[model samples]
Target: MTFKAAKEFNTPVGNYCYYHISRETYPIGITQIKEGNSVYIMATPEKALCDLIANQPGINLRYKKEALEFLEENLRFDMDKFCQFNPEIFLAYAKNGKKSTSILTILKLLQHE
Candidate 1:
């Protein structure tokens, strides 16, 4: 899934897919992964978590406890790896969204732990 500046058309199918279009730099969070002859650029776990929360429309993360619960239970993120996550790309993606604060809050919590 390549990042495009403009939104593209996708036919409805049983499988769900998302294409993030932005005027800013693309793949704000990504790493290259190779499997056999194929090479793919995909979001790191940190970016994936950020995108998931950011893309949601009206999720509430105002409370630290609730936010932590969501991350641990709903998202099932590995807290251990979170300490190694880089926020640069997630920040870029979250810059325009209301969820940026929540993302930062989570990151801050993870870092302090």
Candidate 2:
């Protein structure tokens, strides 16, 4: 997955592009998968969420309730799958990435779930 600016553009194939800036914002917990003759590398869901929070401007998830609302209402993130996310990834990202408050709140939300 790509992490650059928070702008999205429609591709010819109708897929939306989401990206971010800065090397520090690059995702963690990446994995590579091979299918047939092709290989693809992508970030884990935890890292992707962190990257989204850090790079997407105008988002304000300062409190746990706000973070939860953002996840449930704005992103419609599946709470059932929330249990599978690695809290360590969010912790690591909060230590060195932008949006520390929002990231930490997300981690706190995970812990209480």
Candidate 3:
């Protein structure tokens, strides 16, 4: 699937637009599928993989330092506590190298020079 985001909706966190739907009490990551019309998977990891592996088809929410910090501060050791609660996504992230992936991307967005 193509990773497409609304150009008009960039967030203060940068890059990935905030997935706000109003009804959602807690803000969770969301990808707007124009074709599938699915809200996509929540920010959790396990369901993200399940959605993709099971062929649910959703874009991954890109995050860097701020996101990691948020996850670390709020989530800590338990991976499932994040929103919809998926663990495999974290595993996939670790396998793919989170340091180089979103972490680098995060620094670039926040750099002030």
Candidate 4:
């Protein structure tokens, strides 16, 4: 499932989008973040990383260093919180080599970098 912002709505926060796999429908690694009086159900760092790779099939994270740079610089992921996640669940969603390899590569980089 894919959720995109409607053009009819305008906000200073820009557009928000999300993609989810149908089989993995259960809401896992999701948390609530409040801003002022509004609360939002957002995915955890782990879930967000998996979703990023899954949604973008053409992503180029060829090497460990590349993955590190992408996650640290391009994405700015929270490493401490990310490492706390269960690696097994992340691997379960990475069906093919594309997302799987990328996730694995990032995990490896997390160890040394």
The number of the candidate with the highest lDDT is 2
Order of all candidates by lDDT, from best down to worst? Answer: 2, 1, 4, 3
* Per-model RMSD to reference: 3.6, 2.7, 13.9, 4.8
- Tens-place lDDT digits, model 4, residues 2-76: 333323434697755444454443254467999999998877667667767756857766598788678778888
Please write out the lDDT profile of model 3 over residues 6-78, one tens digit for every residue: 2344567765433222222222223344446555444444323322322222323255545446445634635
Ranking by TM-score: 2, 1, 4, 3
Clashes by residue pair, model 1:
none
Judging by TM-score, tell me the better candidate of 2 and 4: 2
Best by TM-score: 2
What TM-score, computed on C-alpha atoms, does each candidate reach?
0.69, 0.80, 0.25, 0.58
| lDDT (tens digit, per residue) of candidate 1 on 7-93 | 445556555455564545355677899999999888777767776776677766766787778978987867777667776665676
Number of the candidate with higher lDDT, 1 or 3: 1
lDDT of each: 0.67, 0.81, 0.36, 0.63
Extract clashing residue pairs from model 4: none
The TM-score of candidate 4 is 0.58
Task: Kindly give the number of clashing pairs for every candidate.
Answer: 0, 5, 3, 0
Q: In candidate 2, how many Å is residue 58 off? A: 1.4
